[model samples]
Target: MDGPRTLVVSGASRGIGRHVAMRAQAAGWRVIGLARQTDAGAPFEMRACDVADSAAVRETFRALRGEPRLHGLVNAAGIASMNLLLATPPETMRRLVEVNLLGTMYCCAEMGRLLARRRGGRIVNFSTIAVALGLRGEAAYVAAKSGVEGFSRAFAREMADFAVTVNTIAPGPVETDLIRHVPKGQIDAIVARQVVPRMAEAEDVWQLVAFLLGDAAAMMSGQVLHVGGA
Candidate 1:
């Protein structure tokens, strides 16, 4: 029998990232979860690492060099602030860029290199539908996720030869703390624009993830899939 494939999901402590890690583990992947805190008695093996800190990410992956080969990485670690370009604080903008964009870059660099060496793996980077819709009051958040979308496409090309498919998922707002700060009216408006007119469930996203990480997605790379139903 084949051993369980290993997956690393950053920001696994909460929100969509946590959902992804939990579901993946249930599906038989040996999951290593990364977050700011290492809580006691988590279901999967958890590691504390700040994705925004490149050095920390590097060292964390270095420690994992002795573990099972990493077959997948989910760059789900991100932060967001909803505000107009003028009203948004500089500090909030900086944090959004740092955690959402820079953090994804750091993990991809470290994990991408490792997967390239092995010549096979999968990478899924979280993006937001705001990039396509240009949602108001989310200038910083949209910009940051835009960077993720762009990076995933180019990275996919670079990794294609190694059979490491890189893809980005741009999901509309889900019922997670990630959007808890947004006004209910705002979320309803966004949902109305979707063809399905509803919030995304974790399962909806995971169905896509399962295919991306499986053998079926070998020919699919450099793609941005929208679960937004727009």
Candidate 2:
């Protein structure tokens, strides 16, 4: 008598998070979306929660404890700023690390508990190609995402005994609002270095996410998959 298979997606108000929620819903999974700004028109259930706020994330999951079959979590919520290390303000750097790294860690901690109790689940966090390519203008952002990659690797090992798998996806120059403010030349340069010289669409990332959440990826954990060939 298990309930419906469910997924909790953060940053679902827009961008890649919204796309993942939509695709998961269309595929028949029950999706609960978390964001500071809730989307009224989203296909799945939307809740107001900022993953960066540890208390908010905890209360949100406490509210969702009724979902008996929580199958996965996708921590796609993140923020970025393209500024040199010295030029970046302390507040800005802190926000980047808080949202991009700590926020992800918070959600994983809460959801990891639920999934562990269920004895199996999936976790897909987001990193960035900037971390791999050492993109010059985004020092704070790159450092934050690099932390995500490292954290996922360690988390996967800790969660292994419970049959829970943790993985990360690093996308390059995705066509989303996250990159709209970045300079065109910067994006172009990054794309040109990719094996596939094109900005990734949200769908491109979603396909890999779908793989990681499926039975096919049961053996894949603690891996950072780079899309757009970065």
Alpha-carbon runs more than 4 Å astray in model 1: none
Model 2 clash pairs are none
In candidate 2, stretches whose alpha carbon ends up further than 4 angstroms from where it belongs are 1-3
* Candidate lDDT values, in order: 0.90, 0.94
- Model 1, 22-128: lDDT tens digits are 99999999999999898667788899999989999999987777656679999889888888999988899988999999999899989988898888999999898
For residues 1-230, write the lDDT of model 2, one tens digit per residue: 65568999999988999999999999888999999988888889999998889999999998888897788999999999998898999999999999999999999999999988989999999999998899998999999999999999999999999999999999999989998988899899999988899988999999999999998999999999999877
Candidate 1 pairs with clashing backbones: none
- Per-prediction TM-score, please? 0.97, 0.98
lDDT of 2: 0.94
Instruction: Please report the candidate that would top lDDT against the real structure.
Output: 2
RMSD of model 2, in Å?
Answer: 0.9
- For model 1, how big is the CA root-mean-square deviation? 1.1
Which 10 consecutive positions of candidate 2 have the poorest summed lDDT? 1-10
Per model, state how many residue pairs clash. 0, 0
